[model samples]
Every structure is written in C-alpha cells, then in structure tokens.
Target: MMGHAHALSGIVGWMAVVPLLDGHEFFGLRFDLGPGEIVAGSLVCAGAALIPDLDAKSSTITQTYGVVTRGLSAAFNWIFGGHRNGTHSLLFALLMGGLTQALALWSELAVQIFVFLLLGIAFNGLGLGNDKNRLASEVINAMGTAAVTLALYASGVNYAWIGVAVAFGCLLHFAGDMATELGVPLLWPASKYRFGRNIGFTTDGKVERNIVTPGLTIAILLLSFYLFPWPELLPQA
Candidate 1:
C-alpha cells in the first residue's frame, strides 16, 4: 500500500491487537516533541509502519525507501531466508533496539534518528503479519513499541498510557501493511508467514481492496475517541 493507503488501512488492520492489548492505548504514546517534532515522530512512526513492503520492489513506497534499504533488504532476504529470517525476527528487533539505545546514548540527535528509523524497521517486522513466525514478529513489534513509546515519553509526552496507546496504534500500522497484496514477513528466523498487506491489489496499489484503506483509516481514527482519547488536533491524518 502507498503511504496514504497504508496510513488508512494500518489503523484498521492493527486493530486486531486491541483485544490482546485490552483497554491500554498503545499508539497514543506521546513524545515531548513540539508540534513540529510530533509531526516528524508521527511521520516516522507511519514510515516505520510501512517498512516491510520494500521486499516487493514493485511497490512505489518500497522503492522510495531508497537503494540502501532496498539493496540491504534484498540481501537480507537472501541470507535470512526471505521473510523468515533476520528482518522478521525478534532477535533482529532487539539487536536493532539495543543498537538504537546505544546510539541514543551517543548523542541526542543520534537518539532521535535511531529511535525513528529503527522503530520503522521494527514496525515493518511486526507488519510482516501471520507469517508462520508470529513469535519473531511479536518480539520485534514489542521492541519497536517500547522504543517508540520511550521516545514519545522522553521527548515530552510523558504519559505512560499514551506510550501504550502509541505502541498499539503503531502496531495497527504494521497489521494494516499485512492486508496488502504482496506480503509481510511478519516473522523471521522462525517462520515466514506473509501477513495481510493486500488491499485487493497486487503491486502498484492497483487492487480492488485499495478502496478500503481510506474508509478504514478514518474509522480507526474515529474509534480512537473511545479507545485512546488522544488529541490529534491536526485533522490531517
């Protein structure tokens, strides 16, 4: 799915986790970012949410992730056993998280970049979806969620509940990626289960289900009133 489409659909798909997370608001994790920073963080989170689609190569969004990510993704796919290896694995997410923390300790700027970018990768891992490797996928998602929430709180949105909401919301992005037509390597190093990632279309966002993303995203944002109660005043999701 494209960013806009992913933005919309992700909210709905990740909703599945609501039951697992219970009443906790996972995606609303607020960071201390000023309006600008919050915008950046949200964008980063959304981008992270979309990272898993790069493998398809046919996807415009995936191609846009850049040659480094794309090349590395391809190489990783070859070495780690497609969606079932390093990229989709929890071990990988931890590795990335640990790396992010270490980098964060290096400098404030580094922390922000690492936090956002690494979270993106972790989100991609989570969105890999029901790929027989749910364990790996969940681990990555957990780590990604923690990293994102920590950043949110550390940045300034200190409410722990908000962090939970942030985690839940971001995971929804990953899940949304599942419904795409290509596939998400949700689990790595254990199972190669390609999650949803199919909005009726195959590549290029030309599928029938693509029509559902906008409505789905709006629905999710609306549902957040009862579920999260966060103030997303932008009115421009």
Candidate 2:
C-alpha cells in the first residue's frame, strides 16, 4: 500500500478501536480512555503508520526527513533483512509499543525533544531553496509548528496513549500490506513465512485505486460519523 493509504488505514483502525477501548475488555485487560487520550492516540497512530516504510528511500516518510532517516533506515534494513522484513513484523510492533510506553514516563521532556528533532529534520528536508534566506525561513516555519505542538502537549494532553496508538498503527500497516500481492512477513527471525500471498491487488494496481482505497476511505468516513454523530441528526422532540 502507498503512504496515504496506510495513513488512512491507521486512522480508521484507531477510530474503530476507540469505542472498544472506552469500556470494553480484551484478554483480561480493560481500557478507560477519555476524549483527549483518544485524540492523542489517533494522531500518534497516523504518524507512526509511516514508520514501516522508512526502509524505502523513496517512501513518503523517508523523504519527509530527507537524509536524517538514512542511517536509521539502513540500520533497520541491515537488522531485519531489508525492506519488508522485521520492521513489518508483529515483534517490531510490540517492541515499538513497549519502548513508547517506557519513554512516556518522561512524556513532557520526551515530546519536546522529539518535536525539536522533527522540526530540525523538516527544515533540512523541505527542499524550498538552497539559498540561506530561504533555508532560514523554512527553519523558522518548522520551529513554529513544533512550538505549537509543544504548547498542545503542555495544555494537558496525555502522552501515554501515544505509545499505544503507534503500536496499533504499525499493526494496521502490516494489515494493509497483507492486502497486497507481495504480502508481509508477519513472523520473522524464527520463520520466513510471508502471509497474504496474492490475496489482493498488486501495489498501485487498478483494483487498489478503484476498489480498495475508495472502500477504505468510505469506511473511515462512516466510522467517523459513527464515533461522533452530528447533533442535527438527532430526532426532534
């Protein structure tokens, strides 16, 4: 799947799970999330949905950070046996979620530092112009966006849910890939099993554009309405 498709899937997945997490139980555990937590989770999931594709240099996520992601992507490719290996695996998802949870202990500081680093990457990657003045302007813009994000965090947003959202987003990425012809290695290291072989259309194929993407988009819109129904739709008393 493409970057936008994966992002849509992640958002839909997060929204679908929100209601379940609010008062439902799963595997002997329960979640009681509030509105702010749900928003944070959705944002994190949407952002992390692009993480698996970091291995591909031409991928949207990679280009977003430009050269800053090269080393990390290379490291991942080396460790996971290239593009669709470990990074797309269930093990990777669990590890990422656990790491996020651990880091959430210093949520405020962690978020601030992360925002700063991300802005720095954006400043370098925006490809506005090589001129010093243009570069400086882009940097300022990136910093301004980061500052706004930091302010939002300081305004009482819960960061713990971010980790959970990222984990779920990665998992949804795997699921989206599974719908492609190439499939994904759901289990890695222990076995080289590639699941979802030929189950759906090829990458960027006609069916994907005409059927899958549109279907997912419609589902997302419907789910959004289900989650937050309009007041105008209420019956008149």
Candidate 3:
C-alpha cells in the first residue's frame, strides 16, 4: 500500500480501538485515553505505520528526514534483509515497541522529542504540505508538528501507552500491505512465505485510491465525532 493509505490505516485503527482501551489495563499499562491522548496516539500510530517500509529507500518514511532517515533506512535494510523482509515481520513490531517504550521510560524529554519527530513524519505521510516545493514543505511540516506537540504538552497528555500504539501501528501497516498484491511477509526468517500475496487489489490502484483512501478519510471524520466530546470541547455560548 501507499504511504497515505498506511498512515490513514494507522489513524483509523487507533481510533477504532480507543473505546476498548480508554479505561482498561492492557499488557501491564493502564490506559486513560483523553482527547489529547487520542490525538497523540493517532499521530504516533500514523508515523509508526510507515516504519516497516524503512527498508525501502524510496519509502515516504525514508525520505522524511533526508540524511538522518536515509541513513537509518540503509541500516535497517542491511539489518533486516531488504524491503518487506524482516522489517515487515511481527518481530520487528515487538522490537520497535520495546525500544520506544524504553525511550519513554528513560526520559520524558526524549519521548517528547521522539513524538515531535513522529508527528513530522505523520504530517508528511498525510501530505500536509505542498510537496512540489521541497523546502517550503519541510518548513511547513516542521511548524505544524511543533504546534501540535506544544498543544498536546500543554494539555498534559500522558504517553504511557505510546509503545503499544507504535506496535499496533506497525501491525496495521502489515495489514494494509497484506491487502495489496505484494503482500507482507509477517513471519519472515521463520518462513519465507508472503502472506496474502496476490490475494488482494493492486497497490495505489482503483481500489485504494477510490475506495480505500476515501473510506478511511470518511471513517476518520465519523470516528472523530463519535470518539471526542464535542460539547465539552466547544466554547460556551
């Protein structure tokens, strides 16, 4: 699947699961998902959804931070055995979640900085800026990312569940790819089988561009209204 589609899947997947998680404990972490947490998790998930593709040099996530991400992509490609191999596996999700959770546990500032970076990636994936102008796009993406991060910080958003969200996002990405013709190898190394291969629509084809993408966009809108307390958020008349 394409970058935007993966990003959209991340958001929709997170929001779809938010109600089940809002007041529950899962995997030793208690979730108290408020508005800020919802938004933060969605963006973080969106960013993470692009992570499996980091092994692909031309992936949106790889191009997100230029030299930094490019270098990371090269390393991941070498370590994971190229695009759609180990990085697309379940093991990759666990490692990413573990690393992100460790970062959160280690330093609040580091987590915040990481969130800022992920938000920037999410914005780029969602095509928030005019890509025709590369410099302008980067500047705009940076500004937008900063604003959202600051707002979430001011709202006292707690990111205790960030690791879970990241892991879930990567899983969602795998699901998206599984829906495409070139399916993901969810159990790489253990088995070289590519699950769901040639069993779905073509990537970025009619199904994705027309049906999937639009459907995801509409879902986000509907979920926004359903998940958020509009009356509480609105200014008093």
Candidate 4:
C-alpha cells in the first residue's frame, strides 16, 4: 500500500479496535477507554502507521524527516535485511511499543527535548526553510509540536495508551502489506515465513486507490458512528 493508503488503514484499524477495547475482551483482557484516551490513541495510531515504512528513504515517514531519516532508514535496511524483513515483524512492533512507552514516561523536560529533536528533524526533512533560516525554522516547528504534545499529556491523556496505539498501527501496516505481492515477514529471525502472499492488488494500483482505500474509509466512518455515543445528541421527543 501507498502512504495515503497506510494512513487510512491506520485510522480504520484504530476504529476497528475501539469497539473491542471498549466493551469486549481480547485474549482474556479488556480495555475500558475514556473519551480522551480514545482520541489520543487514535491520533497516535494514525501517526505511527507510517513507522514501518521508515526503512525506505522515499517513504512518507522518511521524507518527513528527509536526510535525518536517511541514516536511520539505511541502518534499518542493513540490520533487517532490506524492506519487509525484521522491521515488519511482530518483534519489531513490540520493541517499538516498549521504546515509545519508555519515552512517554520520561520527565517533562526530557519529553520536550525529545519531541523538539524529532520535530526538528521532521521540519528540516520537509524543507521548511532555506539554508539561511533552516535552523530557526526547525527550532520553531520542533518547539511547536513539543508544546502541543505536552499540552495533550497534561490534558489527562494516558502515555501507555499512546504506546499501544503505535504498536497497533504497526500491526495494521504489516497487515496491509500482507495483501501486496511482496508479503511481510510477520515472524522474522526465528521463522522465515512471509505472510499474505499475493492476496490483494499491487501497491498504488487502481484497485487500491479506487476500491480498498474507499472501502476502508467508509468502514472507518461507519465504525466511528457506531462506536461514538451518538444517542446523547438525539432530541427528546
């Protein structure tokens, strides 16, 4: 799937899980999410949906951070043995989730500094400023994103939920790739089996653009309507 497709899938994936997390149990565990948690979780899930593609420099996730992500992408390709290898595995998802959780637990200053650095890289990658004012623009964008993140954190959003959202996003990415010709290695290092094996349309194909993307979008809208407390807004007759 392409970048837009992956993003849409991320949102749909989050919505698909919302009902399960709200009033149902999965693997013998249930999640009782509040409204704030649901919003935070969905946003994080959508953002993290691009993480798996970080191994490809031209990918949206890498392009967001431009040259900053180039090195990281190269390193991931090297260690994971190219795209759809280790990074697409369940193990990688778990590691990413753990790392996100740890970072979310850091002190306010630490979190701010981390977000600033990440946003700086992202802004620079996106060509926000020319050589003359690049540094200034990077600082401004980084600070802005960091401030927003901090405000959300202070507004009763749970950090653990953010980590889980990211993990689930990656899972959805892997699932989406499973439909492609080059499937994902869900269990890498230990098992060399690639799942999904030519199950869907090619990446960025007409079918994907016209069919799958629209289908997922409709699904998301319907799920949102069903899961959200719409009855509260109904008029008393």
Candidate 5:
C-alpha cells in the first residue's frame, strides 16, 4: 500500500479505538485518553504505520529525515532481511513496542525526542507539503512537526500507551498491505507466506486511489466527530 494509505489507516484505527480505550484499564495500564492523548496517539500511530517500509530506501519513511533515516533504512534492510520481510511480522511489532515502552520508562527527554521524530514521519506520510517542491516541503513539514510536537508537549499529553499505539499502528500497516496485491509476510521467518496475496487490489491503483484513500479520509472525519466533544470545543455564535 501507499504511504498515505498506511498513515491514514493508522489515524483511523487509533481513533476507532479511542472510545473503547478511554477510561479503561487493560493489562495494568490505564487509558485515560483525553483530547491530547487522542491526538498524540493518532499521530504516533500514523508514524509507526510507515515503519515497516523503512527497509525500502525509496520509501517515504527513509526519505523523511535524510541521512539519519537513510542510515536507519540501511540497517533495517540488513537486519530484517530486506523490505516486507521481518519488519512486517508480528515479532517486529513486539520488538518495536517493547523498545519504545522501555524508552518511555527510562527517560523523559529520550521519549520526547522520539515523539518529535515520529511526528515528523507522520507529517511526511500524510503528504502535508508539496511534492513538487522538495525544499519548501521539508521546511513546511519540519515547522508543522515542531509546532504539533510542542503543542502536545505543552498540553501535557501522557504517553504511557505509546508502545501499544506503535504496535497497533504496525498491525494497521499490515492490514493495509494485506488489502493490496502483494501482501505482507506476517509470519516472517517462521513461515515465508504472504497473507492476502493476489486477492486484493493493486497498490496505489484505481481502487486504492479512488476508493480506499477517500474512504479512509471520510472515516477520519466521521470518527473525529464521534470521538471529540465538538460542541464543547467550538465557540458558540
């Protein structure tokens, strides 16, 4: 699937679960997902949704941070057995979730830096800037990412569930890929089988561009209405 499709699925997926997760406790973690958390999780998930594609040098994720991401891309490609291999598996999700959770537990500064990086990836995946103009787009994306990260920081958004969000986002990416012709290898090393292969529409093709992307966009809008307190947030005329 395309980058935007994966990113959009992440946003929609997180928003879809906000209601069920809010004010609930699961596995000893409290999910008090207020407005700030909802927004932060959405973006974090969106960023993570693009992670599996990091093995591909030309992927949106690899291009997001230039040298830093390019180096990571090279490393992931080697460590994970190339694109769509180990990184697309459940194991990868678990590992990433564990590491992110550990980081969150270890140091506040580290987690903040991680969030900033993820938000940058999210903005890039969401197609926030002009593709034709590279320089302008990077500037816009950087400024937007910084502004949003700072805003969420100022809002005191607790990231206790960031690990779950990251793992779930990867699953969402797998789901999106499964909907494409070349499915992801969810089982990975254990079984080199591609689930949903040859059964779905082509990636970035007509169905995806016209139906899937638009559908996701609409879903985001609808979910936003259902999840947020619009009446309270908006000013009365």
Candidate 6:
C-alpha cells in the first residue's frame, strides 16, 4: 500500500513533537518544522512505517530489509515460536530507538532527525502509510522520503552526513523485524528478513477496514496542506 498517503505519514514524523511530550527539544530549540522539514524527515519515516511487514513470505520490502526473505522464513519458524509474539515488542522498539539515536550521535545528526526517522517507519507498521503502495511503487516512497530529507537540507540542516545516519535508522528497523516472520527489507540490498510464513488471517474484511482509516488519513494529510486553513494555525511555513 505504498502511495501518496504513505509519503504523508512519513512527512508528519518531521514535525518532531513526540519528545516534546517529555519537555525535550532537538537542535537546542523548539520551532515548527515546516512542510519542507516534514518532507525531508519522511525519507526515513517511509522506510520505518513499513518496516514491520518484513515477515510476509513473499514480500519485497521484507526481502529488501536484509537477506532475501526466502531462506530466512525457515529460521523464523524455529525461533520466538511465532511472528507477532517476539519482534513487535517494546524491547525491540527500544533497540531500534537506541540504534537510530546512536547512529545520529555518531554522525552528529540533530535529535530531530533521529526521532522522526523512527516515527515514519513505526507509523507505517500501524497500518496507515501504504494501503496504496506495492513493490513497484518504491520510488514513489523514496520520493516521499527525499522530499522531507531535502526539505531539511534546504532549511540548513546539513543533511549530507545525516542522510547516511537516517538510512541506518531504517536499517535498524528492518533488522528488528527480521526476527519475525512478517518482516520486510525496506528496499535495501534487494534483500530483508522475516519471522513468519502467515498469520492465518484472511482478507475477508481487510478491504472494508482499509477504506476507513487509510482513506481518512489520506484526506487529513492532504487537507492539512491543500484544503485546510493552515495559516490560522501557524503560518504555512
């Protein structure tokens, strides 16, 4: 389900408001990240959003996350006993967060970049970003990622080094999911990991459910830009 909507969720991660809940700020100050920033942030965001799907048996994202998904599925069935049980826990989340933050620190990235990259990928796992995307639509997602990444660059973020760091954030996410069968590679090295072969769930009600949230999310993401009265909130950056 990769498409314009997936791009938007990744873009939203650029807002960098999560850590603010704990009263911390990135870049030594708190300022609104304009759509440009959001666009740049979406690069890693898009990768992370879909990171959890790596467990699917034939998924391309899974294959791209690390090693080819074909051989790894066997190892997964043996470990953790199942997919949803092991890989999606808070333990892995912390590992991912720490790894991304470490990369950012190693690369001297701003805290904002580290957090948003994690946000973008996680949101996709919640079943929101790519209801419209498929294997062939990767560049569509990449463009979405680049839009946010470049926006940060244009805003004087010096993303030249941070870009590699962001990719590592994506790598951490993909690798974490590799511990499960539903993993994805996120389009790197043409390979990825997985933890399961199937959840035994049917597609019977998926269409109806997907039409609700994914569709609504798309509407909001778009209206926030093209339709919503944005200037009233903060001045359209």
Q: What residue runs in model 4 are displaced by over 4 Å at the alpha carbon?
A: 23-32, 108-154, 230-237
Q: Per-residue lDDT of 15-46 in model 3, one digit per residue for the tens?
A: 99999999999778999999999999999999
TM-score for each model = 0.48, 0.78, 0.98, 0.76, 0.97, 0.47
| Colliding residue pairs in candidate 5 | none
Candidate 6 lDDT tens digits, 105-183: 5765455554444433443344333545655344444455445555565566533223333443334433333322334
Question: For model 1, what is the alpha-carbon lDDT of residue 214?
Answer: 49
lDDT score, candidate 1? 0.47
Candidate 5 lDDT (Cα, whole model)? 0.93
By summed lDDT, the worst window of 10 consecutive residues in model 1 runs over 157-166
lDDT of 2 by residue, 38-148 (tens): 545555676677778777767756656546777778777788788988888888888887787677666668865654453333233322232568557556656665764
lDDT of 6 at 71: 55
Error of 2 at 221 (Å): 2.6
Summed over model 1, clashes come to: 42
Better of 1 and 5 by TM-score: 5
lDDT of 2: 0.69
Best TM-score among the predictions, by candidate number: 3
Residues 159-190, model 5: lDDT tens digits: 99999999999999988888897777898889
* Per-model tally of clashing residue pairs: 42, 0, 0, 0, 0, 41
Q: Using alpha carbons, what is the TM-score of model 1?
A: 0.48
Query: How big is the positional error of residue 30 in model 4, measured in Å on the Cα after superposition?
Result: 7.8
For every candidate, C-alpha RMSD to the true structure in Å:
11.3, 5.4, 0.7, 5.2, 1.0, 9.6
* lDDT sort, best first: 3, 5, 4, 2, 1, 6
